[model samples]
Target: MERCIDGVCSGIFGSAVFSDTVMQERLPKPIYKKLKKTIKEGLPLDPEVAEVVACVMKDWAVEIGATHFTHWFQPLTGVTAEKHDSFLTPTGDGKAIMEFSGKELIKGEPDASSFPSGGLRATFEARGYTAWDCTSPAFVKDKTLYIPTAFCSYNGEALDLKTPLLRSMEALSKQAIRILRLFGDTTTKRVVTTLGPEQEYFLVDKELFMKRKDLIYTGRTLFGAKPPKGQELEDHYFGILKEKVSRFMHDLDEELWKLGVSAKTKHNEVAPAQHELAPMFATTNIATDHNQLTMEIMKKVADRHGLACLLHEKPFAGVNGSGKHNNWSISTDDGRNLLDPGTTPLDNAQFLIFLVAVIKAVDEYADLLRFSVATAGNDHRLGANEAPPAIMSIFLGDELTSVIEQIETGVVKNNGTSRTLEIGVSTLPVLPKDNTDRNRTSPFAFTGNKFEFRSVGSSQSIATPNFIINTIVAEALSQIADRLENAGDFRAEVNAVVKEIISKHKRIIFNGNNYSEEWVAEAERRGLPNLRTTVDAIPALIAEKNIRVLEKHGVLNRAEIYSRYEICLENYIKTIRIEALTMIEMASRQILPATLSYVRKVADTVASLRAADADYSCVKEELDELVTLTSGLKAAIDKLDQKIKEADASEGDSLSHARAYKDVIIPQMNELRAVADRLETIVDASLWPIPTYGDLLFGV
Candidate 1:
């Protein structure tokens, strides 16, 4: 692999991608124009044009050393899936020729029974279709051409995340265009939600990762003692990267760039072993695909450098956990960001309407927003003082917050003039991009031109959260458009609508600290829903209001919404069950035996001191404490084992199972961990079976 320096790397970017530029060069003029129109305008793809484009795409992929092809889709399993097939077809002469057709490129068949369907499909009805999503470009990787697609059942039910996301995008575009037309903007045909998801992960030594059964089985450490120096001083944030980690990041960027992923920013995170990678914004669908690729490439690159990339939300306790900051914004087809608050946003009615639409949407569908990022792994991070709380709120900076206040009060207050900082030194240049102080603790923060959704889990897919955002905002925009379309006075109607939204939904906008207990109480008093766990939040998916919004926007039907609710609950239950089982195994086979051996050693030391006629008080005290800890450890282990057995025996629906796991089994697991962690503190490091927090955090 050849390395290109930063300045000379522009040419290498998108080299392996079948991008629009490559399509234009390789495809005929008419075919390229038709395909681009289909992609941009969301029109039906012409089969004749697809055939020509497919042949050209095949030639380009083969030239780049691709021998096989696959329709890559994101299923409901929260990860990507693909099935590869060689491009070879048998000839009459016993040889083979490489060939690809428009039909094959446009469709794929994968077994549906193998995936989680939430009762949408039975085992006998094992049929699913993968249709090519032409909007997201194809790319070549590992001698294969990967075409992005959306998966669905034979009956047309969405079996994957991409289908609903695409539907939501179209819904949002339609409503946004209506609003734009009302504002006298006719040239813009579509509105696209753009996203820049900042990925955070931890890289630990491969040797250490392999030794921990908890990490290997559950993707998180079920049990580990806290390190002495665990981000306490906060020195690791933005610190210089070590040579080994830097090499891994370099290779990761190169691989991502080849696939046309805009890998832009890299830096150390607050945790010692954690790091963050942020890309430039792209359309929502493409950004989702690129982010998935970035995460896969991050692990693959780390493996080559003899490391294990941990994307689990709470890979370690007593430190900052990882989160994917979804910086999302909306833009017009002609390149105008709707969220851009120009010099005098108070006077910009168009921007104000769009802003209030978001506020109303977030306030109305706060439960849906909460459930979008809910997962068993994320439950450990949320409200843990490191990541955002489970409660959903918006953080419009001081300027926007004040604007909303004025609208609510029906008083136009002048916002103060922008001020520039003057340093004492003459040579220092003034900063340019400083508009408002950033709020890291806010879950959904409006930072200058975009709202950063900070509640998304690192390991989870961004497709669900983005789709929810699109659908809710579309509903709000639709309501505004309906009122304005009938109003006799356009300007008066616009002000009335904006003021009404501000008055009703202003409670969701909180500029104060979201991590504080005071805010939690205040939010409860304000009638905001705080869903603190995956199980608690998952039920909101099938709420009457939520289903109505989704169905009205054509994003998802009622059946699909119920199916997803079941799937989420089932997934959460399975995840916690696996973690509990892994904890049981580690405690029974590793921790208990090691603690017993240490107790024997301590007893021996005390005996020797007494035999020598010396004061054995210290040694005797140590042995007594060891005995007490061992007793507590054994009792907790037995209790956890009993609870696991009870949970396994209890048979019920997915919701009941999940509730049992959360309400009954989790408390027992926590008790076991408490005792085991205490034992780890007293036991010898050499006897401990798994890697300690210090080694995993600092060894890299």
Candidate 2:
């Protein structure tokens, strides 16, 4: 119940987490030091040390009134999964005693077949293991000790998102260290990728949400007419929060804070009913875990306040969709942000090298970057005016772009010194943080010290995107290190590498509007791959170059790569299939019937008016329009049904099947929606079966 408005609430923050502070306080010094070493250095945990740590963890959990423990992990389903076991062990005398073992703490067995393995494991091959991820702290949730873990199959293939993510983080760190050594940074042992995921979502009344079958079934309004008043006036952005929403957010922050999630900022988003929560940055692994927990907590807290949190990328059309802006940066264990362009960026050779490496990675592997954010839900949001385009591009602000330009050409020009902004009134203070204007349209934008990846879907786990980024950048860094380590002159070699990278990858940098058609044509001219849909983008995962880089870094082997490709395609097809079926059911059962009733009422009114011997021209015209719309709706429904049947019966590989859904079935569905939405505009509000967009959007 503690609130953190301006000052820190010392004891309330991380109250439920088994954090490093908790370990230092509760655990013996030697055991705590050993465990810290294992966590920081990635060394194998000593059995004796684990036994002592497990005992202390169990005691702490029991002290906090937890009777059960669970190994929480992130699976391919894009959510956290766990199986709980009680602490009580039955003694021979029929009495129970609390017990926990090092073996149990270190590993767990979960059924792998039940989860999506995508040909990695057969139905009968159900074995999977969850090993403790010691770096991320455990926490108490719902009277259970939740230990973060990494999931894998019996043959050691990654069956969950966390396994590959952890591997990719290691890969990035190893290569980044090598690059740092080339820069004479021997004091730094590891370089870790850090992330701050800004989550955007919508809150709707729970009662209204339940009434909408599409929202319940698909997490979006599959068919709804655009409301008269949307975000057209741009009044919702940064507006004052409503009382109910403020209460929900306060509760949400408290819940997240208990689990050690640094929920820092909350504000209204660009869309009605839409809001955003931004957390402080953490190491990539812990940040991913905290984000997953934050999302779950958001929904749970909303429910308590009689609301449903909608995390879909586009829950409503004609307004802004939600996105998780991944603020990503790299740092060393010894406290240095690699992407930090200090006061004089031109003098910071290390920062320039790292920045160029990111640019090169994003340019060369644009397809892979596109694939990471590809999903059926996101397909509707990307390339729209509200969201970034499907084309991958980076936006380095004026200062860095000028630096890069100087590096590309052999001319170093002083791009004017930073100046303070003055207010017209002398009483007002000057602002200092306005070094550069922000471009929200860019997919990847440099925001001062870090890059913000704005194309990630709201509901995504963020693990895949960060890992893909880590792996690609690691490859670029590895290539740079290879040249530098063998060079006769380190400084000269660094400059040569930076220049070559800038020359090759400068096309990916654009400060203009990405949503413009001209940019699309320009990107095509520059030979940038524009994978516009989930179907178009997912194929990049299996491309030879992508596979080679991933395998070379040991992030994913060939089989693992293929499995993920299959899984992504399968998930896309299934999502579309479910959405199509839901649309068909709603169109035929709810919308068609409702419109037919309204049409019958209109026809009856027209007949009665004609029989009354009065002027019935307006009534007749309304009747004619209703009849035409109803007929059009019927025809659209038939066409959609036929297309769905054809898609269901089509035979091909996963990619081909997905193509059919995307190319043929989706168009048919859009046709059906057009007719249904028109019907909604004409039909009476009482006759409409489901909640309309306005009600769902503004009712909360």
Candidate 3:
């Protein structure tokens, strides 16, 4: 394993990865320098340079016991997709030589029709290309060398998350550098976005997890009565870890660390058996890759520890669900945190401009942000007390809000000093979250520098949300740069823009409780769109303004946008359909049969009591109650089955089909679950077909 040097991160951090340290150690100096320059400047790798890097990378991977290589890419299916190829090349003899070429390293073709292309290609097209993303590092896992790549169609349409994400990063950097030049910072080069997504999950005993068919089919529990004690006492949060859970975490961290993922923090979450792991910040695209790898490693480690890790947003009902809080920020290559309120006059002026750009961007394109995190699993979690509300609002905290207010009113008042956050104000105080009452309820909150997008679901890939953030913020900065670059008095114009931005976009900056009903009502009054569901949020991707901005910034073309829009709806429609089918199957095969068996036993007891000439009223009453619930359960199953069949048969567009699932099918699923959960409480433990919520949550 690599170790830290001089107290700075070096080989110890990304030891297993084909990281910079390994490249420097192995590659010839000229080739290494050329490769690094190309990556840093976001330029295509020269063929000769790629040839050398590929050979060195292959040797490193082979040395690490990697026999096969995979082009690891994120498809539109909201998960990663990869196609593995062996490194062995036949040498015309019985034996073969391990060989990998620059062409193989730079690109590969896979069957495009199988993955969700969202009509970007025909079913018979069967061709997709994976281009090597030289920016993100390669790593070896399970004897397979996984090279990070950007997937696209043969026609060059982005069919994967990383492609658009890379485009957005470049788009943002282009505009940000323009902004930086206006501020007279020419040596900054590239402005890179960073992300640190905190992942939350639940770990259950593997046996208990397998017993529940719903947990097996869907990631969440379809039907389980609430356990008596939940997160109400808040004792589980940050509490002492159980020995088994601790062992799992330890193993998880080790695995993730070897893969070069910065699995920084681990602790108990609000719910029983729930835990969270947060990583240190990394380049946005690399962070997304690390997050996906982290989630995959988490499950593998848990299974080795005799546990099953649940990444579903709402794995259990009536408890705190999981969320992936994306902490995002941007900084210059020369090491300047753009969001930080710097002490010097020049620094303060630049920070104020960038800060206002984010404020204006969030206000103008809140819909895109919401749509970024939209998912069928997340629907059950959002707007709940445990997670941030569905409404898109920013929490700037009280002190920051005060600074913005002073800027808005043109009053420079601060603790017996004429300090202000307004641009062009030479004397300013660097007060970073001194009085920030952090609001967990806010969807997007400013925690000192970075904005934590708390609405992202745990199971989701962070690429989509981050790309949206990058594009929107880039658009805002582009608009500001147009004014600043052309203005005769740049500083005065910067101050004016900052003031106008805060004044106009102040509605997005809320320092109050976001979970309150008043906040919802006030959000509506402030003309904010409350897109509360995945279906409701999906259309925002294709909205006119969103499309315009995305095109203007060259992040995603209209066709690419429409394709993703189709995919999102399709994903939602399929997810609900699968869940509904799973419910119908569970109720009919498992819950109903077991329930009826218990009902028969109860009826037998009633008959015995009556025959014995004893008071039969109590036993008879129990039998009657059982029968009633059993009837309701049967009826609920039939209704869900019918609705699913109808949805499958009668579909106009994916949107309407998705609405049928959301509006009609989801309500019926709840109705079915209610009756089935009630039966779990009354039925005998031994007679029950599956493990109860208590067992799944606490048995671990």
TM-scores for every candidate against the unseen true structure: 0.95, 0.95, 0.97
Question: Model 2: runs farther than 4 Å from truth?
Answer: 1-8, 343-347, 414-436
After superposition, which runs of candidate 3 have C-alpha atoms over 4 Å from their true positions?
1-13, 414-422, 433-436
The best candidate by TM-score is: 3
Tens-place lDDT digits, model 2, residues 1-700: 1123346655678889998889999999999999988888777889899899889999999999899999999989999999999999999898999999998899999765688888998666678899999988999999999999999988889988999899998999999999888767778777888999999999999999988888888898889899999998889999999999999999998888888898999999999999999988899999999999999999999999999999999999888889999999999876578887554423267777788899999999999999999999999899998899999999987766865776677555554743321111111121122345688899999887788999999999999999999999999999998998999977677778888998999999999999999999999999999999999999999999999999999999999999999999989988888888888889889999998888888888888888998788998898888888888888987887888788778888999989999999899888889988988998989999999999988898
Q: Clashing residue pairs in candidate 3, if any?
A: 2-12, 3-12
- The candidate, 2 or 3, that scores higher on TM-score is 3
What would the per-residue lDDT of candidate 1 be over residues 1-700, giving only the tens digit for each residue?
1122366668879899998889988898988989988998998889898888788899999999999999999999999999999999999899999999998898889765789877788666779999999999999999999999999988889999999999999999999999889878888878999999999999999999999999999899889887789998889999999999999999998899999898889999999999999998899999999999999999899999999999999999888889999999999976688887544423267777888899999999999999999999999988888888998999887766765676666654554643321111111121122355667889998887788999999999999999999999999999999998999988778878987898899899898889999999999999999999999999899999999999999999988898899989889988998999899899999999999999899898888989999899998988998898888888888888888788878889888889999999999888899889988898888888788999999999
RMSD value for candidate 2: 4.8
